[model samples]
Target chain A: MRKRWVIGILAALMVLLSFKKERLFTEPSGWPEAVYDFKRNPPDPAKIEIGRLLFYDPVLSRDSTISCGSCHLQYTAFAHVDHRLSHGISDRIGTRNAPALVNLAWARDFMWDGAVNHLDVQALAPIANPDEMDESIAHVVAKLQKTERYPALFYAAYGDSAIKTEYVLKSLSQFMLTFVSANSRYDRVKKGLDTFTAKEAKGYALFRTHCSSCHTEPLFTNQRYEYNGLPIDDSLQDWGRMRITRRSADSLRFKVPTLRNIEFSYPYMHDGRFKSLHQVLNHYASGIQQAPALPPSLQKGIPLSGSDKAELVAFLLTLTDREFLYNNAFSFRGR
Target chain B: MRFFLLYLLFSGVIAARCQEVNVRVTASFSGKPLLLESFYQLPGGDSIAFDGVRFYISDIALYLGDKRVYTEKDSYHLVDVSDEVTTHFRVSATQHFDKIVFHLGIDSATSTSGALGGDLDPGKGMFWTWQSGYINCKIEGRSNRCPTRHHDFSLHLGGYSGADLAIQEIALPVSPGDIVINLPLDKFLAAIDLRRQHTVMSPGPGAVALSKTLAALFEVSR
Candidate 1:
């Protein structure tokens, strides 16, 4: 009887030890707490791997020709490069440019229009969109269930071969929550390890004076929609936040994009009309269209000299974190 | 031996008497019972046919006078006129309660929490893809009075924010036996001008107004 008791206690200890794995995500120093409810879907190595596979697989699309990685490439900080607009399955063009995927665990809302509220459900938009994947969650689960590789993967992640939508979404969130970009030059300077050059420092001062109110620090975004005074696109007639809120006051307001990897994730703004930092600076300096919904700070437009523009661009480039762009862990592994 | 047998018999009687009760919901277009794809005449002399009618009922609580006795956990239910399997729910309570209260839509807690399973799942087509809230009520049908395509009207009502909150609490007097809740479609149509505002796909002022009308349409028969 004592031997049996000792064996039972040892087995229980082993079970407890198995559950106490090292933390997969660590909060960046001096940053706000993550908005994602990690308690509901705790991270596991197996689940994150499964989510990474799902992210790379084209089976998510209707024609099995487009995967999330097709639009979001890691080298460009997980944003689509070159194309002003996103290209989807069957070579179809999407309305908006794909935003960079970094530090998403801190975001309460996703998309330029703030359409998706949670990270777990953000994948659904791309999957169901006709121009994008156009595949249903139920169909995706069914397809995965038939695959020999996925059943084993699902069992390892969730302890069951039953591949449900909830598990799929949770796993995807687990993978995405690991995308923390806090290693930029700006971050290193703040941590007292590096000092900015004269031009970068001057640009940082200009940014604090002009752009810090909307694109606030350490996350580099206030996560609110603002009208930066871009004139309406005649063809698309995109009304930005008004499409979601339906309020005239919210017209032309778009969720401010993070500048963490601005060097690589170019073709800026909601429509990606500006291809270069020079064009974006010129828009702020002289091209702000007068509108009722325009932000008060940009009402008279940002006054910047030629050198000021160059300095601002120099500072913006310091935000590019090469560690994140070249991280091999986020890359696709062969089957 | 005799005493043990008597005790067992007494406990059995008590168990039977204190068993849980089921509340079955049935939809109707006025006084008549409603069936899927059933045609009914409006008071305005226009004919209408309902292809689907479903809504979420959640956060149920049993009140004994001023004191609360029972509250159900994970109590979200999607009641559909088309699905007989989800039309009924069991309410278990040891004590007597004079009234029961419930919300028309999911509470703010569940609405804010990301991706849930079963009835609250997005697979049920009750969730908004762009926004992050549950559709409180979905009423889809074809009416000759409607001027839109296929003469169809679809109202999906739910909101979580202030001034746009569509979830309403309703209290109904009840007894311990089986209960039947009636959702009167005719009264709901009469309350709103479907021609002027037939379709509401998202949460806003329009959805909140229709949800108020829907909240008043339920009558419990004990």
Candidate 2:
């Protein structure tokens, strides 16, 4: 028993050494503690590179027609611009708009109705959705394994070259998670290196009063599902949050969108109903739809005037995130 | 003097680590060898055999008295059910354990951030894309009640936040020499009365209900 005890102690030290794996991510100073707890499974550079390759690869879709980047373009904060709703493989139109994939680590929930709860698995929905990538996970894994490029890439990223479902999804998630939208002009201003112009600052004040309650600052979202007062369109009739919960009370409670990088993340709202900030401001000012799920803050329909609208638009533009848009580090590699 | 004491301590640690014992952990669903169909009983008894089933067992630990022995390097295994008859797990640890504890899924840190490859890779069907989360539990099988005509059910169950959390802890014994803990199929009966339902494929109240039963299989005996 004593000998066994000594052996036990030594074995534990080995595990301690193994578990002492290096942390691949750092909580950038002044940023909130990440919603993703990297301590349990640390991020590795190898995995991130693999994820980047997959992100740009079209192998994730059926018929080899679409990649995740198809709808989530980098120039537009990963939000699609060609259509009001997302268009996927075989030209299938989805019911809801594809929200910009920005600063997702800070998000509380995912999807218009918050159907998904974790970031690693979010890709499964689009990959498997018939109206989207239209590909099955098993089929995709086989396809990836057969691809000459993927095997080499997987070997470089992960020591073993075997292409399985878990590695593919995790690698893609690594790339998406690193697509952090933290380098905007607003970020610089927040860091105290710069100041907002008069129009921008004035607009900022109006934003704080009229919209900050839901589309909060910094991260620019509370990350809760809220009824933003969007009236249901007769043609699409997308019910937003109600579809997930089957609760009448949640008839239209869509996940609150981040106002960060709003300038580039337009046509706003769940359905991409508005093409410009002015229209969004107009809806906020007086076009709120009345319903039980209408957020308590917007029930009064923000009482801003024409000048206020102009000021709000200027403030929204401050969130353009120029560095995020043009950052060469995030650009297509070997393109 | 400090260096001398440190050398003595380090030597003892290395010596202890050199000694090891092997333990086997076999877990199956119901009384039968686990087929994806018999296991995942979702809402409304729509039972179906799945195309696949995958899960991870992490943080296997050994406790001898107050001290704990850990699996240093590769302590996780993604059990694939394709050709293997039993989900056989033979672990060699550098510790004499009086007890053992492990997790049924990869811990929280690995589920988010950075990219992962191999068993933890996202390309694996176990991960979710729309919600950007890992599906720690995957069960696909045939069921009559499924809306998909194949009579097939794909239940990807795992969520960390809110009420949908599925991670659970299991504790067992290391046995003085060789210890084998069996997570038999009957535990499914312990967890659910399959007569009521056979299908649960998404994240909600149903997944949590089933995972509770799954966590009850750990035993601390030698």
Candidate 3:
């Protein structure tokens, strides 16, 4: 009886310790409420870990040659910088650049075209894209079920060894929800913990004047599709949001991406046309393409001199959160 | 012991009052039952064979006159012609209903509400991966009139937004008994020209138009 009591108490203590060590999703101070409905699929440490594993696993691809981490590297703030268009399995080139994955909990829609309405189903796009993973969600679930490690992991996360599409998606969402990057120099300055340099301060002022309307603060995006006045690419002819909405007025409009990690997430824009921030500024300054439906702010274009462009670049660099970039928790872990 | 006996008696009475009505969906070519991969004569003198025919029926509610009498909880059914088991489902009704109302496709809200399970699950091949909406109805076949490669045609109807919303609510009056819903394939093929509009895999005007036609094709029988 005494031995049984000791074992039961030890088991209870282990449960308590596990609960204490479980990682949680935290909303950064002064940030708005997350758009994600956590009540539907609440966060669990085991589920998040399962998602992290699945994110790094190449089994999601047809040939197991590529993973989400392949395009979205942790060091680059989860955005691929090596290619203009995202290269998929078998080196197949996609149409648009892979946008950086940061503060996704606040995002209303996913993808450059806003094709995916919810984040839970966002991974479906790349997984089933012919140029990307070239695998279906059904096939991925089947593959995971056959894996010895996945059954155990899924059992721990979802309390069932049988893996389904819902569990796979919800777990991935849980892991991504933990990807909170609110420790950047700019964020610190906002919190009164640090101060921005003179150039950065000047750039911030300039950003508020010209760019902050679309790239709003606190989240760095207003989350609306706007026509940025880029002349249509002759070869691609991608209509952006118009393809999804099927409206003439929505033609050439794309979702405004978050400018949180602008330093590392290079090769910018929906198609990654501009290689540098200077080129982007130059586009705004004089290269705004003439269009009938262009927003008033870009109609005349922001007349920014070379010095102002330099200052903007300096301020953009302050948005980089090195802690998020180098965070080991998000990095690849071997099973 | 007396209270338990009384409770059991009350539950039995309640269970007896709730009648289980089986809903059987059948795809018919003209007046005859349709079979998959079997060639059938079209009105245009063209031969056609259905490779697949699947659709979603959701929000099933029974109505007495204009008022809803009973609504099935989580009422989403995937009726796949090839899989006869999926074509039949049971609903419990406490009272009699003259009209059966249901949406021919998933609603806009449910389509946008992240990963769903069961018949609405993405694994069922009903949900579109490239886009976020569910493929409300899928009809893939080969018609001799089709000009495509291998004389094939695929129509996946779905879109839950603005001008492209494809879901159609269908209400049919019926007698008080098990319901048998028939989708006349002849009428559907008669409405569309195979050569000009064979492939419609995306959510657009084609999908919405097809959905509208398909919605009107549902007929209820005792």
Candidate 4:
């Protein structure tokens, strides 16, 4: 009896330790509390697997030719490259660039205009957009119910075979919440595990002086709307946040995107007008369109010489996390 | 014998306190029951037919004059015109309430609470996909005066922010037993010109105006 009791306690301890080892999401050493309320929809391994499968599944679209992964690829830090604007169903072009899906667990709001208020409902925007998936949440649930694999997968995650809108959305969030990108070289340097070169150090100083106000560090975004002084595109005529708020004061403002993985996630800005980092830096230095909405920091413009631009680019490269880009866990494994 | 008599009395009091009341909601046009897809003559001489009519009724409570009495728990009912089962629900309330109070739409706190199940689910087609907010009241129909495609007029009224908060609270005096609430479609149609204002697919000043108009049409018949 004594031996049995000792063995039982050891087994319980082992199970507890293994459960801790298998946690999917862990906040980095010095990060603020995540805005996403995890207590409502805690991460489950089975649910994360379902979310990963759904992310790559084209059945979420009206036609089976598009998926969330089509616009958000894992290699380019989960952002679309090669296209200036987002390409959706039937080769339809979207007005805004497909923003990177990085460190989304920390985001208070989604989209360039802050239209989507929560991450749980964020997938609904692309699914229902005429230019994108063009599918309704109800229809998507029906499609998932009819699928051979989805019912079983949902059952595994939710303990029921009936696929529901809540289950589908919550599961997708579970997968995306695992997309924490805090393992970059800059993060390592911050931890004193690595050191920046002289040029990178100069660029870091420049970034701190000029860009840190809006693209605040750690998560790399202050998560606020700002007019970055880009001239209005006559063709698109997109009013950004003003369209959502219906206020003239918010006319040219867009959500400040994170600069993490800026090396790969280019064709930048809300409209994706700047093709390269040099063009973006040059625009900050010289190409700012004069406007009353322009932020006071960029009222004059960033003063960067040709060499300073190169140094800034070097610092930006340090923001890229190769482990996050190449993580096999995020990649599609075919059924 | 005395102990048994007291036990019986206590059980009777418990049963009376937990008594359930049924609330039935019905839609009508000019004092007649309105049927979906059936043409009705508008006061303005234009014909109208409803394809769908649905709205959320939430935060139901009972009162004695201005004093609070009882409030329903988890009180959200999606009254869809096509589904008679959704039009009525039971609420637990004791006798002696002079007034009934309820909101015509979901409260702002519940709207932003993120993904929910049951009647508030996104699968219900009452949630806007492009923006995050429950469509508190949706009325999709066709009118001869409407100049748009298929002569259709779709009004999805909902907003949970500063100027756009569209939920309307309605209080009605009642004597109590079972209650029946009637929504007159004629009053709703009389307030709007379908030719000029056909579509209100999103929340704004237009939706807020329509919500108020719709809220005023609800009446309780004892």
> For each candidate, what is the lDDT?
0.87, 0.71, 0.91, 0.90
DockQ for every model comes to 0.57, 0.25, 0.78, 0.78
Candidate 4, B1-222: lDDT as tens digits: 999999999999988776788899989988988899999987758899999999999999988889878898888889997899999898877656878899998888788777888888987988888889889998889998899999999988999887999999999888768888889888888888788778997779999999998898899875
Ranking by TM-score: 4, 3, 1, 2
| Model 3: residues with Cα > 4 Å off, grouped in runs | A1-23, B1-16
Error of 4 at A3 (Å): 26
Between candidates 1 and 3, the one scoring higher on DockQ is: 3
Interface RMSD of 1: 1.3
The residue-by-residue lDDT of candidate 4 on A100-159, one tens digit each, is 999998998899999888999999999999999998989999999998889998887788
Which candidate leads the pack in DockQ?
3
The residue-by-residue lDDT of candidate 3 on A1-335, one tens digit each, is: 99999999999998876555334777887889899988788788888889999999999999999999999998988989868899999999999999999998898899998999999999999999999999999999999999889999888878889898999999899889888898899999998999999999999999999999999988899999999989999889999998888789999999999999889998899999999999999999999997766889889999899899999999999999999999888989787
Error of 4 at A268 (Å): 0.4
Docking model 3 quality class? medium
List where candidate 4 sits over 4 angstroms from the true fold.
Answer: A1-22
The TM-score, computed over Cα atoms with residue i paired to residue i, of candidate 4 is 0.95
**Candidate 2's error at B187, in angstroms?**
6.7
Better of 2 and 3 by TM-score: 3
- Candidate 1 global TM-score: 0.92
Ranking by lDDT: 3, 4, 1, 2
Q: Residue A216 deviation, candidate 1, in Å?
A: 1.7
Residue pair clashes in candidate 1? none
